[model samples]
Target: MTTAWMNATIYTGEDFAEAILTEDGRIKQVGSAEDILSSSPDRVVDLNGRFVLPGFNDSHLHLRHLGKQLQSLSLSGTKSIQELIVRSRQYLKDHPDRSRVALTGSGWNQDQFSEKRFPTKEELDQISSEIPVALTRVCGHVAVVNSRALEVLGLDASTPNPPGGIVEKKHGELTGLLKETALDYLGPLYPELTSEDLRSQFQAAFSAAVELGVTSAQSNDLSGSNTQALAIWNLLLDMDQKGQIPLRLTQQLALDTFEELDAFFEEAKQPPSDHLSMGPIKLYKDGSLGARTALMQKDYADCPGERGTDALSDESIRKVLSWAQENDRGVIIHVIGDGALERVLNLYEETEDPSRHGLVHCQISTKAQLERIKEIGCYVLAQPIFFDYDLKVLVDRVGDELAATSYAFGTLMRKGVSVSLGTDCPVEGVNPLPNLYCAIARTDLEGKPDGGFHPEHAMTLSEAIRAYTAESAFQEGHADNKGKLAPGYLADFVVLQHDPFQEKPDALLRNRVVMTVIGEKIVYTHHGERSTTR
Candidate 1:
């Protein structure tokens, strides 16, 4: 059915337009309210002067992780080990089922600990000596387990470190900390999540994304050594095909094993439906700043003579890049530290194609690298939410001088790089507007370190919106069909209660999404109470 939305302030992402008419899920006209309404659509929505913009496209997100996190114990806001323990204890008491319990949560900062250490087995043992509990850090790159968990996994000091991971141990005993691919450290002891559990988490994740106004997402960690996650994703895809999957998704195929990656490249040549597309083959160049695993060219100022290690070998990275280029797949490399950034640039240079793929977290790149990215025209999908959380860690690790250079969004955009923004959800939380707030504020929530962190790198509100919307679509090679609110573009748009560009930078966070429409359907609306058309 044809629909017309009038009395709206429309942002086409290229120009300011007024009113819009849609038919068969494509914009049919863009003109004055009176002129468009003359066509007479099946339904007319008087936007009542609300601001309308293109629906947001999340370039990088873990949909399954988001859903699972909701059902798991949330330790995201805990400030100390004691607080984490208290939170976990309270959850267990509420559930009261130790035999079938698997505690999962995120957001624990090891560097912020009183001892500047990771949670030891002793601390977790004190909290629940009976349950197998694993709490991941905010980054989801590192996790700490309790003695009960370790014992359940049969992991001990004698367990050899798996490839691409590390087991933090002290006194020749497993300290319950797993880093990188070594998460298998507690696997044998951990209970496998039932298919029923995964299905529930998948639905929860999909529901959460739709409620948040996300119609499409490029899901990371789809195919990797993480067998369980991959299987769950397959189930999600099956449900999607059956039309049970409520959200559209693009799944990233991580190149963990050569054979598996080769198989993926073969399968990705024929793209799937809009509901499911093969995303880039993801690779991790370094760890996160929160865990001090992001490889840096120079030693962390806080820890002299210590530089983080690269998650993968240079040769392995080159091989993956070469293969992706030879085939038609794309690459999304995660590089947070300057050292990692340098390596990715060098690899891209060798590949000799600026558009072969994109960089996930190009947080710290040099002037030369920035210029090179512009020259090559690669997408730099950055997460500004890290500006606050990782900034604190950066300040602590590399000192104020280096922290000021982290998450350089404005710099990349000004240099003509294809800059896009995302929440990196669950890692940074699922909210998109707060990310917009960070892009403009360019500082932490409390407004720290006067003049903002890297004031020169701050993005204007308009720029932030484009990064979250238009540029995000460009990242996934959907620029023509998505991003803009122009004629012929998909009828995916959101009506805002306030104009983000017109509102004060700080006040943008206070603004809410009034209504969200995807594919000519109202997926979410919040007039007086929450409602959905899905």
Candidate 2:
């Protein structure tokens, strides 16, 4: 069926238009209302002159984790260890169903804690001595579990740290702190989710995403270590077959080793339909700065001789790269530190097809590295929302000189690199407004560091919007058919409460997605009402 959307101020990606004609979930035409509406169309949607743009496309995020975060205890705002304990205890009291699986909570950062230290295993034990409690830091790179969780995982004093990870030890005893690859050990704690549970999670995440104006996402859910990863992929495939996926999703394969890669390909044969498809290979090159595990060239400003560690072994990364190159697959690695970023850049220089592979969180870097990335012409998925947290501690963690050059959003775009924006959801949030605020405001939510932190690096409102849309679609290798509101593109778009061009940067925080339409369907609308007959 063909649908006509008219009487709207629409952003056809590069410019403005008044109407759009869509058929078979794709844009057939975009032009003046009088021109397109002159022709008969089966359906019509009047946007009421609402400012419209292509639906937001997140270049990198974790949809599965976002759903789980919504379902479990959230320790996000926790400012004190005592408060975290109180919240956990409260969650237990409310649910009282601890037998199904291990207790999981995330979104905590010790940097924000009043005590200025990580919550000890003993402290988590207070939440539940019988139940295994595991909490991940906001960066998703570090995690700490209670003593019981350690016992459940069969980890102890004798247990040694695994490759690219540290099962932190303090005076010959496990601190129940795990970093990088060490997080894989917690797999046993994950209760095998049934097909229904998996579907519910996807549906929940999709609903949340569209409400925030996200029409498409490139997410990392298929991990090498997770045995149930294939089942999750299958669930997505099944959802697409039934047109159940509410958002366009491209799964990033998170296989770190050769064995994992081979095993995954052996079982998972074909990609899904339009709503689902497989994208790049994802791997972690290092950890996060908050945990002092983001590998850097120099020692951290606060702790000398304690430079962060690497998450991917050189041998493993090289082998995987070789395999990917041979199989013609794209690879995107998580590298937050300059040292790690430099190594990945060097490795990518040798890539047979650098366009297909790039880096995620290419944050801390030098001017030379930025220039190098531009020359390579590869994708760089950055999170300006990270500045909400990173700005508060960047100078102290990475030192003044390096911190000054970090998160060069505008610079990358000007230098002509394939740059895109995302929140890395469940870490910051999937909300694009806060991310846009941080990008243009160059400050945190509270508006700290007046005049904005490193304001020079801040992206213009137009630049940020395009990064979240066109550039993101480009990142997932679907630039031609997604992102834009141009002819031949997917009929996915959002109607906003404010015309961003006429508003101040802070006004974005107040901006709301008045409506969201995907695949010629009005999936979400303000005031809890959806309409397609308008």
Candidate 3:
């Protein structure tokens, strides 16, 4: 297939061009529209002076979870515990069949609530004393459950807290809050989905990705249960073979044991296809800032003597890194707090090849840590969109000194660190436009703080775009072949209504993606006219 996209302002990262020509699923040439038209091979697309850039690459997110969230009840914007209970009750009332199964929902933030605290078991028990209820916080690190859920999990005052997790209690009574490792136990309690259900979930996620101009994603299947994980993987592989998957997926398998890892490697001996590939082993070092569960160097400013939980011990982290080095597999760990970052970095230093590992959610870091990240040369999968909510409570959680350096995108780039952008979807939406706006504006959704929250750390338009594209491609080991629009690169790009560089930061959020092309095929087209031929 040969196609020419003309009358477009193409941002190739290094240079701007007027047209791009593709042949056999790769960019054949980039030049003036007249020059591209002179070739006149097969088809032509008049972009009507639209802005064309490389398709977005969300470096880290949970694909299947995003799909499930799309179907589940959302408590994202609930203003109080009363509202949460009301919504949950209504949802239960609407779906009577869910009464038998554990009620699962997410996206509630304590900061957003009027009471400024987590909901208690008593409040949730009002929804249903018979059925188990588990409501996850927006950060995905903590969850609040009802009394029945605790009983179902066999948790009580006599039950000791697991390592690297917390089962919150006050006055010798359970508060229904589960942090870090506590969430691991609740996985088995939730209802299991069938193979057909898994396929439907993935299909919904892939369709959303393409519609949002996301050409590639690095997904972590942290759904628990090795059996279900492998089943979902097989379903994705099947979809890719049948050309049903629209975007490229490089999976970060969540295998906790060496046995599972060995089995996965044995089955994945062959090279990956264009649409599906196995990338790295996924691990968690700590939790999120919102839940106050991220391991920090010191106590939280607002909550004294409370340094957050560390999901893995230093020895465990070292062992995992060593195993990855020995097996020649890369590991991507979720490290949020400065303390967790330090410990994970220390383990990386001990590893034979530090570059073989990547870090996710490098949210809270110091200048020294940023330097170390640059020196280590590991990929940093960051989510700029987090600022929308994290900025609201940053100073209160980490104090002024640490808050200034939080979400330091520009500083990392200046230190020569490879930083990529992601949404961690279900925590935040997978729309790259708002993410780009956050990276540049460094402000909340309403555009607060006058200029920006630490505007000094805000990235330029081009820099943010690069992080979402080339840097993400680098993390997926497709740097040379996929991220740019030059010759020899994959024909994956998005056409937008306005040039991002020429627009204000706020305007970016409102800008729409007109068309999305992957492998030289138009996967999604919202509003565009084109001429085509065989």
Candidate 4:
């Protein structure tokens, strides 16, 4: 099926072009308006002078989490413990059928609280002691649950904290908060939903993604420990092949044990499909900044004595790296603090050059670490959404001194490092436009700080585009097909209302997706618009 899109300006992402024609999911030719129509044998579109660029690809996202969060009560924007309780109570009142409440949300700033504290078990218990409530922090690295939820899971102060996770306590009693590994304590009580339930959530997430010009995304598996996540991913893949999957997904399985890694590598010999593929092997080196557990060299500006927690031992990382290097599998490590960054950098330098492994949240890095990262040729899948969400928290965690260097996208790129942008969805909201806007404007979502945090590190408009598109593909090892608009590439692209380059960076954030086409098929179009395929 040949669909000609002419009379428009196309930023081929490689060259600024006049127009292009797409036939059978590949760019037929890129030329002027008159040239593209001469041989057209199918439908044609009058661009009416709009911008056409490669579709957005979120290199790091959590599709399952996105689906699950859609159904869970969201408390993302709550500012205080009181605000969180109020929201939870309201959700409970609204959804009277939900026996066990999992109030998961993302926007709380531990430093911003007037009490300067995390939500306590006592606080959650007061809201509804009978009903269980588990509220996650903005970072998704920790959560606070009521006593009832803990009781349902048979967890108490005596329950040992799992490796890489912690259970918060005060005065030698459980505080009703779990971090990293200890989070498993709340499981079993919240019964696992059926695959049908999960499918509905995934469909909701897929719909939300396609509407925003995301034809494809990667599920950066951080929460799942075993092959259980991969099982779900494989199911999604089969669905995609049958044309039943709503959106394309790349599964980046998080490694919990060497045995799991071995099993995945054995299964990695298969070819990738239009729907699903094994993406990367994710590793967690440290915790998150919001929880004040991001292994840092210096103590947090607000919380002293705690540099951060290290999730993995050096020996373990080396063993994993040895296996991945030998098998040629991609790696994605979560590193937020400088120490965490330095640790991973050392491992990367020791293994291979330009390893192409991803640093999930390379939030803080020093010149030496950046230089090493450049030398090794690793990629940074940085989340600009955190710019607005974590600026204050960052400043508090690392103090103004180190916070100034956090989320250094432009600086890293100028220094010859490959940097890609992502939402880290469910942790950061699942929107690419807002992140693209932040990349250029470097401003917070609320347009705060007047000039944005460390404005010097802000990326240019073109640079931001590449970071969102090409750079992300490069990080995922799919640059040949995913990032650019060119021949032999997936005919996945988004038609926007205006040329984002012509408008102020902040304005792009407010822009909406007009059309999203995947594999040359119009999967999503603005309501009331004529179908391109019809």
Candidate 1 per-residue lDDT, tens place, 1-534, comes to 778888789988877777889988778888787878788777887777888888877778777778778876778767678887898888878866533656656767765665567887788887778778888887877898888888778778898877767888778888889988777564554357677777788788877777666777887747445554456556766676777665567777775556677654444333345666766888889988777788899888778886776898889988887777777677888898889988887788787675757889887665566677777666788888777776666677777665655677887888778888877888877677778888888877666656777788899888888888888888887888888888888888888888877877777677777787887777777757433211
lDDT tens digits, residues 1-534, model 4? 777886566887878777677887777777777777787648887656667888888888887778778877777766677887888888778877654445444445566666678888899887788877777776777888888788877877788878888887778798888898776666665666776777777788888889888877888643354556655655575566667665567778787567777775555445356667777788889988877788998777787788888989888988888788787777789999999998888888787744657788898876567677777888898888777767766676787778777788888888888898889887777778888878877777888878778888889878877888898888777888878888788888888878887888778877877888788777888886553332
Candidate 3 lands at a TM-score of: 0.96
TM-score of every candidate relative to the true structure: 0.93, 0.96, 0.96, 0.94
lDDT of candidates 1 onward, in order: 0.76, 0.86, 0.86, 0.77
> Which 10 successive residues of model 4 have the least lDDT summed?
98-107
Clashing pairs in model 1, backbone N/Cα/C closer than 3 A? 152-189, 153-189
Clashing pairs in 3: none
Clashes of 2: 0
Model 3: per-residue Cα lDDT over 235-305, one tens digit each: 88788888888888888887766766767666653426898888888888888888888889999998999
For model 2, the run of ten residues with the poorest summed lDDT: 525-534
Off by over 4 Å in 1: 96-101, 111-117, 194-196, 226-233, 265-272, 527-534
In model 2, what are the clashing residue pairs, if there are any?
none
| Cα lDDT tens digits for candidate 2, 366-429 | 8788888988877799998888888877889888888888899888888888789988898888
RMSD of 1: 2.7
